[model samples]
Target: MDAISLCEQYAAEHGMQQKNGNAPWRLFFRKEIFSPWHDAREDPIGTDLIYQQVLHGIKSGEYKCDKEEELASLIAQLYYVEEGPLEVNHLENQIYKYLPIFELKKNKLANEYWTGSIMYQYRRQFGVNPPDVHHVKESVVSFAKCRWPLLFSRLGKPSRNTCTIQTVSGDEYYIKSFNSQKIEYLILAFLNGLKQRSRFVIARKNQCGDDSNDLLDFEVGDLLELINGVCGKELLTETLVRGENTKTCLQGFIQSENVYVLPALIKPNANVMIYADNRNDFNRSQEATAYPQWRFGRDVLDMPLLKKLEGRKEQCNDAMTMFMFIMKYMGDHPSRRNRLSTDITDVIFKPAIAHEILRDELYCQLLRQITMNPSVTSEEKGWELIWLATGLLAPSPYLLKEVVQFLNSHQHPIAFDCLNRLKKLNKGCSRKFPPHFVEIEAIQNRTMQILHRVYFPDETNEAIEVESSTKARDLVCQIAKRLRLRNKDGFSLFVKVREKVLAIPETEYFFDFIRNLSDWAQNINVENSMLQINYQVFFMRKLWIDVKPGDDTNADLIFHYYQYLPALKPISRRTFGEEAENGNLPSHIKNLHMIRKPLTKYFQCEIAK
Candidate 1:
């Protein structure tokens, strides 16, 4: 019989006065209110902590010398009268409830050790519908079977002189070893003292009473919170307490639960205002569509977006897929669409399988539509693609590249449109696709042809010299300081400033001119008379101006120059031609040649006294 029913049976045998004569059994059985607690301890056999105590008391039939009637009276006081009927079959019904059975009988503490306020605290905090204690203990035992000896082995090994583990928040911690015994006691005390508000423990050796080896402790940055496991417990310490504190504090401060609300959900609609200057009415709307919205709320807080989320599931999934495509086409502008990138915990992209989609159907379709439409100007085409690419339907990268190449080869207006699109695309991806992309030579020749026919077909190079001179005069004035002129010798100024300017070719022409000067320095030393005359003849590129004699102001007269200089062999430049076209270089190539030609000549030029 169970505890309550056994007491009732004994009371009946002793002829104890029964109220309502209902077998005194229904007073102690509310299955919902009577669930057992999970101990989270490392024991899986021998005895169940709560049930064993009751079993022992029943078998002994000793109730501190109280008669059966008195013991029955105590049970009645403990449980409600209406619950008496449920107690009659408690022993049979109780069989369904599980309990912890410790595996290690020898080292186990008495049942009393698991009793008192700890049980109450656990129920109040974690809830009454606990896991079957015995089954949980058994599972824990199974988990510990391999770990016990392994843990001891870890303890026995020499301390990791130095080692680190990286946390998800990007902080690395040096794992320090300490005596497990000392740490065990410290943990016990820390748990005991948790009632205090400012609960801080000194982690160094000698902080606690135990004289065992030093314990493990490490620093983590603000991005992540960490809680360590107690010696024998399996609770995720940080997740429980720290997470609770976070929720509680947020609740108190905000008076609402929109703490992690994403901007993509709230705030005003991010509408693209397309003002047509050509149209007489500024208010004329060509076409308008509200951006498909993705609102953030409570569902994504406990789990990431990668989890199987419901409500707006279609929009969320399409947003991600479409956003990836848009990024590949015109480069990512996450802020433009009010989208925030959250860390994806799940593996969504597998490179071996996921092909770049932008180079495929969607991109080609857009290209065709924009190009074949005679009414669409280049500017109109650009704006349309920008809207389309950044919209919820852009394709992936590998496909986008293929589409652009197809457009280029066909030489259709679509091809030119793609070229224009490439120009307008974000410069951040320029490294990914170099300027050599798009068949630049052909594009340049085409551009020059257009300029000749449309802009100045009849003007000879000499005929435009005067106009070009005026332009170059203004240009030289703008770049005088940047050229860093010091000596009257043009060669010295060019040599000094060439590298500064050449390092970034995209800078203004004055910079590009200096860059070309640096590149042509070696060629100038060549003995070819024709090359020298060619240098002087074409030197006055359209931007060059004749500075009249008396109007001098230390002005450095330089011209815009572009050349396809012989590609300098990288190894030759570094090793100063000491290594041959196909020979193993001597070891002294670095150290011994440190004072070689360029270095020696450079230092000599600067330090020549």
Candidate 2:
């Protein structure tokens, strides 16, 4: 029989009904039984196992009890259906909410597994939602994919066994399904445990020594003792203090019944050590370490505290100590020495400390420190040294000599840049360059030559001579004559520029024609410049009529024609007789007139004959 018929038979025997007075098995059969069964058929073992479990439960009289018992029996039958043998130890109490088994031994085994196995910790960490269980399973699968590729590869295959025996290097390691399942449970537990440990440590570190409310408690910026993980003890300045009521710690606060103290000190733990007391000093040290060649100028080093602690030896010791440390660091490298020289001009060589630190001995020592470094200098390092030398408070003769010597020895782009700047400074200000910088001047000259060559080509030097006196009327006449000869029929001539055509007006004067041509050329190129012209001819049909002998004597019988001719058109003529009177007609048309004269002579000769 079909799944629905079998479900209805079972429901009738078990007295099941729906709220609408229909059979409950009608809906349940479609959704729960038939759908699951159809989907499970895709796997070869699923359908057979489910059918065998359902039949076994019915034959064993497990579903012969009340409604709850029947439901539980059915669920348990479905839950235990799988490819491998059901391990009672692996099924914990979490699964029993759906598969309500009444067997005492199975229930007790599930309780033991829940309390003792890592599944209990997993549930405590992430809750017992179905999605949480899926998350744990996914995490396990991902871990296995990364750590053990061979084992994970067998998981989804239908024919693969859950348990396997393998020999590796003359040894046998037992691989079982239970081990993989157990590991899936333990990963979440370990992560949750580590999270709790970190919270506890942070809590203990923030507790104050005094319990009295009147005492001035420690705030951010208070100096305190920090226990370093590698080093023993170090002093640290607090940068931030987070309260217990803050959102990040709110859960812990509520869980502890709000007994956790307020205003927890948030300091960098054992990983970082802060040696300086003030922010400026700390920042300076950090910057010096990160970019060792960066120079902080007088504007930066002119702190208010420097003036207050000028003569006080004890109070200024920290500043002096940091300076000495920076100096020592700078001395260790050539680039650092360059930066140090610039920095000292701002901090130590100021007017206040001029006598103390910027003496003749110190000046010589600094010059030696800058020039004595044997490291091969690159272009960038050469520029840095030049910057160091240029920023000195009073340009000493020895210092300038040493800078010029360095520039001479290191001839590069950077040296050239420095030389150009120095030359400009000498012209604009009191600074002067030594006589040994002839190579720098030569480099500048050569650079100018290259730039001139690159920007100016030979063809651009020759001027294009355009005749400015060419009249526009002459050009228009030339264009019209050319168009008339090319197109012998009645046609109009136009000058085509881009999409538009310029038609020659019949009464246009010479100046107007010149202006229009100039406007056209200006639109094409620039004003009053010569423009290339393109001409167009539009042809029209002509109907010529001969004049009779009694026509007016002033008429010359030459008629211009149009494309659209009227049915009865009047014949009128404009004068071409002026060309005949002046004998200006071309030789070919004049020869035709000469032939007419000869024909009249022939007629006279015939009459005589």
Each candidate structure's TM-score, on Cα atoms with residue i matched to residue i, is: 0.16, 0.16
Residues 409-494, candidate 1: write the lDDT tens digits.
44244356445445444322211111111122223234311111101111212111111011223333323334343322221111
Clashing pairs in 2: none
Q: What is each predicted model's overall lDDT from 0 to 1?
A: 0.29, 0.33
In angstroms, the error of model 1 at 594 is: 37
Instruction: Give the 10-residue window scoring lowest on summed lDDT in candidate 1.
Output: 251-260
The ten-residue window of minimal lDDT in model 2 covers: 450-459
Summarize candidate 2's per-residue lDDT along 1-609 as a digit string, tens digits.
Answer: 487777767776777856554465433211112210123325444444434433344335432334533333333333333212234455553354433244424655754543343333333443433333233333332332243334222232233223332221123444445455333334333333332222221221222433343222332223232222211100011112222322122221111111111111243333222221132122212344465223221111222222435665643553443334324434332224323222333343333223332322333333333332322222233334344333222333544565466555443455655544444433322211111111223332433111111000111211111111112233334433433333232222234445664654433332234334534655676542433343332222122233222232211111121111131123111234557568765654656544534433443344355
Tell me the deviation in Å of residue 196 in model 1.
Answer: 84
